[model samples]
Target chain A: MIETTVFAMQVLLLVMGCLFFAVGTLGLFRFSDTLSRIHALTKVDNLGLGFIVLALLPLAPSLAGGLKTVLIWAAALAASATSAHLIARAVHVRPEPPEAKESADD
Target chain B: MTLILNAVAAFLLLTLLIALIRIWRGPAPADRMLASQLFGTTGVALLLLLAHAQAMPALMDVALTLAVLSVLAIVAFVTRVVRIDRPSSGRKAGDQPETHHD
Candidate 1:
């Protein structure tokens, strides 16, 4: 009974994670602006990944496998944050329009 | 148990697809960067799921490396922006008129 219950929980978590991921993707496609897309992608992606990882923990075959799973989760979180920051910075430094340049000179 | 993992993996794959769209159609460099970040996150998640399914411990190293590299890339990009925005030495090449010693 306990094993069955655990399996059910894992399945539930996985389904929820997938649902979140799907919604996040939809948000990306629906949003008009980059910032809005980022907002959707970051929040949903992070939570979705976290839940998926959590679901996998119980199924890990060995102690080492479990440890590794946790480590990957940690890494994902760090990488996601940094990558978002870089992308945002790149957008901010783009060249200004010709009209804006002319106005500045005037 | 395996069913759950499979479902989650499938979802992660979908997320990756969305991120790819963002990377390709993003309006600005920052947007692309954000997409890439999403890719990194999804990649790590996928790796974790795979490791669990396959019972492999070595794959975690790949995720760690990816995480570190992503951060390094962000730092480099930020520094580049700062350098570009800094004042350009505050002196012009053709400023002889302003240097009169009389």
Candidate 2:
């Protein structure tokens, strides 16, 4: 019974992670602005990868291996947050009209 | 378990494809940069999933490298593209108050 329970949990977590990733990508299409798109990608993808990392921990071959996996997740979070901030600051310092924007009137 | 992991990885790949669309149709450079960041995150996640699915621990190391270095690309973009508007001599015009020459 416990094995089946764990299996179900893993499936659910993985599925949830994938869904979050999809939503993050969808934000790129739906949001009209760069900052908003960064907001979606950073925040949502962080959660998505975190879930996947958590799901994989139980399957790790050793304690060190598990910690390594977590480290990957932490590193990714840092990279995402830092890059997002840099991009947003760059945009703020010099706002540019998008090169191929569509008319808002329609 | 392997099957489930493969399916999840495939879905993440789909997400990656959608993000690629944004990069390709970028209305702005920042938009493309943000999409590239998304790609980096997705790549790391896919690497992790691959490690588990294939029982190859070394893939985690590749993921680590990817996660750590992905930000460098954006930093380069910011320094190179965003700051190109002005001279790179470490000063912007009118940044200091003018004083009469003696």
| Best of the candidates, lDDT | 2
Would you give me the overall lDDT of model 1? 0.66
Among the numbered candidates, top TM-score falls to 2
**All candidates: CA RMSD (Å):** 9.9, 7.5
TM-scores, one per candidate? 0.73, 0.86
Q: Assess chain B of each prediction and give its TM-score.
A: 0.68, 0.77
Worst 10 residues of 2 chain A by lDDT: A97-106
lDDT by residue (B9-92, candidate 2, tens digit) is: 888998898789877787667777776587568999999999989888889999998887788888787776666345444566
Q: Report the C-alpha lDDT of model 1 over A31-59, residue by residue, as the tens digit.
A: 87776776777788789888887888887
Clashing pairs in 1: A87-B30, A91-B30
- Tell me the spans in candidate 1 whose CA falls farther than 4 Å from its real position: A62-65, A89-106, B80-102
Clash number for each model: 2, 0
CAPRI quality band, candidate 1: acceptable
Model 1: per-residue Cα lDDT at residue B96: 38
Native-to-model Cα distance after best TM-score fit, residue A52 in candidate 1, in Å: 0.9
Worst 10 residues of 1 chain B by lDDT: B80-89
